[model samples]
Target: MDSLAGLVHGFSAAAQPEFLLYALFGVLVGTAVGVLPGIGPAMTLALLMPITYQLEPTAAIIVFAGIYYGGMYGGSTTSILLNTPGESASIVTALEGNLMAKAGRGAAALATAAIGSFVAGTIATMALTLAAPGLAEVAVRLGPVDYVAVMVVAFLTVGALLGASVLRGLAALGLGLIIGLVGVDGISGQSRYTFGLPVLGDGIDVVLVAVGLFAVGEGLYVASRLRHDPPELIKIGANRMSREDVGRSWPSWLRGTMIGFPIGTIPAGGADLATFLSYAAERKLAKGKRRAEFGNGAIEGVAGPEAANNAAAAGVLVPLLTLGLPTTATAAMMVAAFQRYQIAPGPQLFAENSALVWTLIASLYIGNVMLLVLNLPLVGIWVTILQIPRPYLYAGILLFAALGAFAVNFTPADVFLLLVIGLIGFFMRRYGYPVAPMVVGLILGPIFERQLRRALAIAEGDPLTLISSPFAVLVYAALVIIFVVSAWLRRRRSAASV
Candidate 1:
């Protein structure tokens, strides 16, 4: 009942004219970025972060949330039409979506993607709203040690699960820790990695890193791989789906949402994980004729992955809202935005900023609807964006990257750092090192360190006390079991394949 009341209040707040307009703007920008190759919502949001400083916190968050959903919707467009995935989560969609397009079922693929996203978004949003308050209540009881343990789990999980190799992921995480160590020490007030540079006293800006890695690095990588082959636009068939297509997709959407939402809310679980799992689930449940279409372009393949992507995106908000823990790069950026606004998420957020939290939740539903409406009718327009010349598109991306990075601090040093980081990012990508974990590490490292220190202080330097709490011990046990079981299963699967 209390949650219901809060939601009602949230709806009232989201209904305001200014908030609605911002939501629409966010969806528009997000969809555009998502549809375009080599651009993502994280980069788009980072580019907009400085500008958002002028808006109210609630409105800014509402807009950001809108972009998050809209980006997922737009990402599928490229995958289906151009055989290019705009976001990592859309990679699975490309497999079947592009096949469907080549087979002249492009309209069906696009419609399924859009409709599945809407259904998944709606269901996941409801799950977020209902689950968030309860989780927040549980989080309110956690001590410093518990918080430290939770963060360690998050760090380990993110680092281990993000990349092809745990070693590379940890290496990226170590780099982020090194970056986090640059500022003045919170406890001793001693500058560790500042190297006598005054600007380093405040630490590297998160926005700078985000823009450098996501925007500049991504643009440069794409430029280097630029092919002269003009993208063949998939012919648009009837935009409307037949009853048979609808029947096949609706169940897949539901099943994908069910699989995706819970997994996405877990530590180290994001859209990538969710989509893969959903694809597997769909494959497992597929009937005789449909089963044969697993590798080929099946409507279910496009539908399930698209649904999972949207559902996982919505589910990421659960931890962000309840514990101030960001499960994805975009969520990490949103954490930075919260800090810029002097707003702390977590259990206290619900108590202190109920209106803000609820309103943001409410806005997600509105955003999903807006995206569906925008995507379905504007499919042709989005596909037209693919005609943009590679050089011009990349040039524009580089320009935005420069402007966004410069906006962070207006310093020449920051620009130099952006270039340096961008170069590093380029190398990392070339070597198959995942960039997501590095951003996660950079964002979460400081928080983990702070909580660890606080826990130690409370424990009077007794190391055992760090895991003495029941919750901490339980979580650690779970982590150990998961790692061992997962490793064992992988070995078994490899042996069986051999």
Candidate 2:
């Protein structure tokens, strides 16, 4: 079926009351996670993955879709009112939104953010709906060699673009590759990295790795940096937008969506780049009266970044659905979730699991509306959630991390393994290493190995055959271009800084 017909089918499947409730619950949890500082969607998804064990695949997926987008909108509350960004992408939101709130234009900031997210999300979802089906058709024609190329792009970009330094990101990716390769070899059925232990032969569970790195690891890292004082919050007045606010924000919203969705679909960093680009665009475009507001509580800054952040989130789903390429940490966790159900997301996904894919797309549309409704009128509630002490918040996360690890196989060994991984995560954070590339590598490494093996077998062990395919050559060329461009950009920035 075509995209439009598939969407109709999706709406039919997802519009049921039960699925709606699941979506609602997911958004509520996601929003709360965003409101709480130091907790991110990846960690939230990791901690709550046990829910997938209880609910059916469709229900669990619907809820998760809600959480994904809701988290995007949820950060607006804390970023604006408390100046504490819950996630890296929201850092820009706090930059301008907090100023607005401190100036007692808190209501206007919140209004623009909520409405702008809605506008961007809805438009981006429309783009996804139209774009994904055709992309899936193209992806279906790709061979194993082409898949290897795509995965290489995913790995190289993820490793090079994430974290404080390229070396740190690559190191994290290497660690994940090592851990992912621990199980018995699928082709030979021989133990590879088990070290003669039966437990190692089974390989570490994805749940354990995810919870350790995101939940337990983060908890430990944050605990090491706890402060004695609580942060003061700005009191928000009535949450409503003025006509002038609407006039200024609409253009920024459109521009941010235009900038964000395309970036989200690529591997060159996701929402972070989109937000920065949008912020720059808004600043450059601001006219006479608006120019002076750039540093102090500019509504355009908040509106544009917030819109881009949400639109980029929608854009991320495109590659994930069509090529099984996850561009972010949360997207990697989503891949893990798909694997849990033995449902691979890629070219054949639409042909084999059409129902599931369509329903998921439909849920995105529902989730957009749900978040707008949830965020607009409930500003005070989220602010209240933001006041939660970091100690209690992380304590609960650690507890859930333990529970999730133990629940994996009801084994104490898994829990121990979780702690070991968590410690690694702590050290990574302490040393300016990023955990996202590791998660992406951990999830994609197996897929890459399998694809590589398949390609090699087809070529009868000829290494040159790997690059013989035109698509593979193109992918590598693109990789080189990205690297060169990024390096040049870095040099330019350094020169300007000097």
lDDT on C-alpha atoms for all candidate structures: 0.86, 0.89
Q: Highest lDDT among the candidates is held by which one?
A: 2
Q: What is the lDDT of residue 251 in candidate 1?
A: 95
Clash total of candidate 1? 0
Question: What is the lDDT for 495 in model 2?
Answer: 63
Candidate 2 minimal-lDDT segment of 10 residues: 489-498
Q: For candidate 1, write residues 4-90 as lDDT tens digits.
A: 999999989898899999999999989988998878888888778877778999998988888888889999999988888998889
Clashing pairs in 1: none
Best by TM-score: 2
> After superposing candidate 2, which stretches have Cα over 4 Å from the reference?
488-498
Give stretches of model 1 more than 4 Å off.
Answer: 484-498
